[model samples]
Target chain A: MDLSFVIFVEVLYGVASLVLISAGLAVVFGMMKVINLAHGEFMMMGGYATITAVGYGVNVFVAMLIIAPLVVGLIGLVVERLVIRHLYGRLIDTMLATWGLSLVFIGLATMIFGNTTTGISTPIPGFAFGGYQVNGYNFFIIIVSILLVITMYAILRGTRAGLIARGTMQHSDMASALGYSSDRIYMMTFFCGSALSGLAGAVLAPLVGLVPTSGGAYIAKAFITVIAGGPSLIAGLVSSATSFGLVSQFFTFTISPVIGEVALLIAAVILLRTMPKGITGRFFKGKL
Target chain B: MSRRASQDVTITLVVSAFLIWFLPLMISTYTLTVLVIYGMLGLSLGLIWGFGGILCFGQAAFFGLGAYTYAITAINIGESTLPMILAVLVPAVFAALLGAMMFYGRLTDVYLGVITLVVTLILFKFMNSTAGPQYAIGNARLGGFNGIPGFQTLNVPGDPSAYIWGDTYFYVCALALVIVFLLVTWLLRSSFGRIAVGIRENEVRMGLMGYNVAARKTMLFAIGAAIAGLAGALFANWGEIVTPNLFSLGQSAEIIIWCIVGGLGTRFGPIVGAAGLAYLKFMLGQQSMIDNTLIMGLILVLFVLFLPRGLVPAIETLLNSIIGHKKRKPKPHRMRRARHG
Candidate 1:
């Protein structure tokens, strides 16, 4: 019974982390229809921001929760005004331009960070749970993700700003006809998406050693999660993350971590093969 | 044949002949061979991406598969001929399977790109972790991060005793590239290639017109994979080593940059792009003061923003404006049709 409880926590943790990793990409790609290939880089910059802030003697929570997201969001705002703004409707061109941006980010990071791994220890300590030790940080991540989902749902569903953003995303001309500037909406949405990515990176930095190219490791996973989630933003993100998280964790506990990743990718391929429209696209229909 | 067609053939032949003769003297066989291999790789992508309109993010996966397949087969059989053939065949077959799944599933372009990227990254991750002795397939060990080296290199067909390397190998690579280039040009002019391009322009219309768009796309994708495999086989011979880095994101990104910078939809553009960029990368590798990736990234951004039509198309436009009408002039309508064709 104790081991099962531990396993349950692990699974939840897995699902939450997947959600966190892909939240920014979900906003950018799902709503905006812009493939921000630099999504992972934005997260990487967030991680660096958190580390730098913490080094400058700020509170760890403040560094992670505030500074990192602000820095990365500002960067995103600049990227939006410059590159993404120009290649709005052209899908392939946007992908190429963003890919170039990703490379540029990686190059800049390598130059600044000296191409070496840097990381901080987890603030929370491990505690005993029956025979196995449970990471206290896991609980922190699970809480953060729960709160994130609630906040996103509440804001997007409840606020007029969210409605305007959604309206602009669906039909910019219609949104513009109603007195809201679609350009400003797009710019703000991009900023939020980028900030979310940064937050995810900052929160997760304690778990892994950070490298300039660490973004590459997360790009595929985040893309798979967001793509597999389908159209309905929050519902799709939660459901797919839950399913993939369970599948990957199950395999990880049963076999190995690498096989777990392989299984997740294979599952995604099979899922895409079966449901080309994604889970939310078929089932949720019109839920945000 | 049309006068324009014959003229194009004559120009291609003359250029190939001149390059084959002159390039060896201008640069070392080592650098030239690498350039030729990269050119072939770029052409593979150019064929599918430019003509077929499939922007695969993992051409490196097939390239890596070809290299690994050749290395393993060569080590086991101790013959270069079968391994080289297997290299091409394996990636082609793999691509056919992958392409069938994506195309038949009717996934969107973004999903297709994401799937291909994931698959290649999976291969990269898997290959990097296989450092144990149990990872061996027959006599060849999957050397993990250190990669597989010390395999039998390319030799004359059916004769293990005769080895091919240096200048002879460069000549063979250049010949293969020329043959592939000419074949691709010929294929594009055929009815099947025209249908493929038609599907690329409008898949719904092609489907309505009774052409099997999915099957055509899969076939084109397989052909591209085959060409990339051929290049990978040559690369293994040139470098005499195959690492997991062959399947890296950077390698895949570089191939796309080559196509974009050279000019998409043109046969010669990819070769010129690959050769020029790869040579630049080689030069950059010799110095460590400035980051090579920074320069590459800046170039990709600049090219995409300013030179979207690429170097070849831009130059063609320039030539048309400057001296096109004065020399052997043609009607503007014919020129437009030729451009589309």
Candidate 2:
């Protein structure tokens, strides 16, 4: 029973982290179709922001929930104005440009952080749970992801601004005809997406050793989850993350973490092969 | 052929001849050999991306596979000849199989890029995890991150005792590059190549015209992989080692940047780009203050923003304007079409 509980928590933690890492991409790539290749770098910068803020003696939660997101969102706004705005409709050009941006971010991070791994201790500690010791941080991540999903659903589904953003994503010209500034909508959406990415990185910074190129590790997994999720942003993100998280955790419990990663990638390939349009495209038709 | 076509061919031949005869005296043979290998790698990508319009993000996967295959096969067979052939064949077959999946599935561009990048990362991770003694094929050990070293380098065909190194090795690599260049140039002039380019321009139109778009794309991808594999094999001999770094994201990005900087539509542009950038990277490695990737990223962004036509095309435009070449000055749209074609 204890082992099963441990396994269950591990699985949930895996799924939650996947969701956390891929949420920003789900918004940017899934809704906007902008293909921000620098999504991972944005997360990396967020971690750096939180770390820097914490080093300056700020409260961890404030640094994570507020400072990181604001900084990254502002950065995203600048990028949107300077680079992404110019290449909105051109998908391939946007990809190349963002890839260049990712490289620039990595270089800048290396210059600032000196290319060494730096990370903070988890604020939450491990505690005895039955016969097994569980990291309390695991539960924190699970709760955060649950809250994130609910918040995303509430905002995107409940709010008027959300409706306008969705409308702009579907048909910017139509949204413009309806008196919404699609450009402003796009700018705001990108900022939110970038902020979400920052929050994720800040939240997860304590768990993983941070490096300039740490973004590369998350990029493939996030891309796979988002791509595998398909058309409906929330449903696809939730469903795909749950499935991949389960698959990877299952393998991790059985074999090793490396094999777990390999399994996730293989599963993604198989998933893409069978359902090229993604899980939401097949099952959750017309869902948000 | 048109008079323009004949002139282009003559220029290519003259350039190749000039490089083969004069370049060995100008630079160290080792650096020249490495440059030529990179040139070949760039050409492979140029063929698929520039002409076939398949923006593969993992050309390094095939390159690394080729290098590994050659190292393993050469170690087991104790001969370089069959291993070299296997190097090309392995990546080609792998690409053909991979291409079939992507093209036949009718995956869009972004998905294609993601899948290729994922595949390359998979190869990298797998290769890195093969440090254990159990990861052996025949007598060759998959030497994990340390990579396979001390493999028998390239040799005279049928005579393994006669090792080809130094000046002769440089000449051989240069000759191979020249041959690949000419073959690619010839291939582009063929009906199949023209159809491939057409598919790039408008896939639906090519499919509607009764051409096998998927099959053509798969063939072109396989050819590109073969060339990349050959470059990898030569690279293994040049460095006398093969590492998982060959399949790294950085390596893959560098190849794409080379194509973009060199000029995508033209055959000769990638070679120049690869040689030039690789040399710059080599120089940057000697310095500690400046980061190579920073410079590369800046260059990519600036070029995409202002000089999307790339170095060769921009230079050509400048020269045309300077010399007042009337024949070259067609209507703008027609000129663009003619240049790409």
Candidate 3:
């Protein structure tokens, strides 16, 4: 394959991954008010679970499908119940509390897994696609992410639970008063968000090595995505993620990744300051 | 201040200072050096969080920045003291600029915390990468992961002294700590400090009252950065090395943990917190039996959940209770009487 084609493929992969992560973040933020700083930790948990399952002689694909989200979701539920549930509405408390929780989680992971980066065996053996030379495992992630996004979109737009979740996001007290249990919505939202993060982790495990501190790398980017996309709209998240990914990749190819990230962050900060409500607000101001 | 409160404050200061001065004499050089570093770290955290109410998790960024700056500048200038000053000044100015940008953008509290964290993480990554053009001061190239070493030593005022081998150096560190502590305390008691406190309590009200809340926060933050920079410069001199770990998230989190553990919003809480935690960590390291971090995490959880007000306030309350002093009570029905009148 040509150099330009390789760069194009890389950029596509980057954009796809960004979209998946940002969509997950949007869903979580739209439903639950929690910032979930440990969201990346959930991803790490999933990645670890995938690696562990592979080690246990399980079919890599099947193991990832079942183990990744399940382990991550379960951890997410426990975290919500134990720590995050108490931190609702209190911003500083939530940030600090989650930060402490992140530390504990990182420490525990390091103790259990040691400081080494763990690898996951690729699922589809030597499967490859086109002149782009795509790895089967990463291809699977891209496909699964697309499927998840579609499924989430359907559930959110079509279901009664989704309505209630959206209502809770709009106003917790009012939602409770109107007989929609905000606590239950919050729990469901937290679980789903965590599950998605885990799924992302599991899917990406084959593509990326899992280190104890890997989660810290993605967190800042995830936050920037959320802010840039605007927390309120799903489509806005999709657009923001794709654009950011493309921009970052383009910059990374031409210049440097570090410079790209800094540029992206500076742009995001400027955008956020100028448009606090985000791009979605321009059009959907009345409805949202 | 009340007579008893003043007396109690005086007693606490004298006792603590005496203990610190005597500690090095009794302990090993390594232990003494560690304690001094902890004291410096605590002073940094105290100035920022306690006075400004800015829960900065990125102090280690400045600390590390100062260390690298000092090391590099010292190598270039061929003088230890001037480089040390440059180290502190560079980071302080960087922090001041960053602070102005953040505060002026109206990012307060959590947002402020996130931006600082992101900045530190970027620095960490940038330093760790080592792929880009190397930053060179004279012939000294920042070796990235390997860090800068064999930099200039601390210059004592009177006698020509060899670097890194004496009780005298530690004594100088002690003196530096005292000066920093007094300087911070004085700053806290000034009008600027009062304005910072007002901003912390009710920034909106302060702004409405014509106080420039952003400027105040920026100034306080810069002061805190300067202190951390000073600590970092001293640290490079003591450790004789500088690494990217200074800019790591772990370092930042550790400082925040120290502040939280010591007691936020109190003058000496950070000192107590940093010293107590550092000593415990040292003991744990010496034993080599337990995971020090796991224990630290547990303590953090316990403190946040149970002792949210932290150790200093808890101690103060306990002391007050032990003294058998009746707590002053507000006059009952005052609101109702005022309404009736």
Give the best candidate by TM-score: 1
Q: How many residue pairs clash in each candidate?
A: 0, 0, 0
- lDDT by residue (A1-288, candidate 1, tens digit) is 889999999999999999999999999887778878888899899999999999999999999999999999999999999888987777777778888889999889988888999998899999999999999999999999999999999988899998888888788999999999898988899999999999999999999899988988788888888888898899999989998999999999999998898889889988888887788878888999
lDDT (Cα, tens digit) per residue for candidate 3, span B34-72: 577767787787777776777776898898988888888
Q: DockQ for each candidate?
A: 0.47, 0.46, 0.35
| TM-score between candidate 2 and the true structure | 0.96
lDDT value for candidate 2?
A: 0.89
Interface RMSD of 2: 4.8
Residues B198-306 of candidate 2: C-alpha lDDT, one tens digit per residue = 8888889999999999999999999999999999999999999999999998899889889888988788888999999998888888997867778887787777677
lDDT of 3 by residue, A92-167 (tens): 5555566677767777788889889888667575444455565555556567767876787777778998777777
Clashing pairs in 2: none
Superposed Cα deviation of residue B142, candidate 1 (Å): 1.5
- List the candidates' TM-scores in order: 0.97, 0.96, 0.90
- All candidates' lDDT scores? 0.89, 0.89, 0.73
In model 3, which runs have C-alpha deviations exceeding 4 angstroms?
Answer: A1-5, A22-28, A125-137, A272-288, B1-13, B131-134, B157-165, B286-290, B326-341
- The C-alpha stretches of model 1 lying farther than 4 A from their native spots are B2-4, B327-341
Q: Model 3: what TM-score?
A: 0.90
**Higher-DockQ candidate of 2 and 3:** 2
Output the worst ten-in-a-row residue range by lDDT, candidate 3 chain B.
B332-341
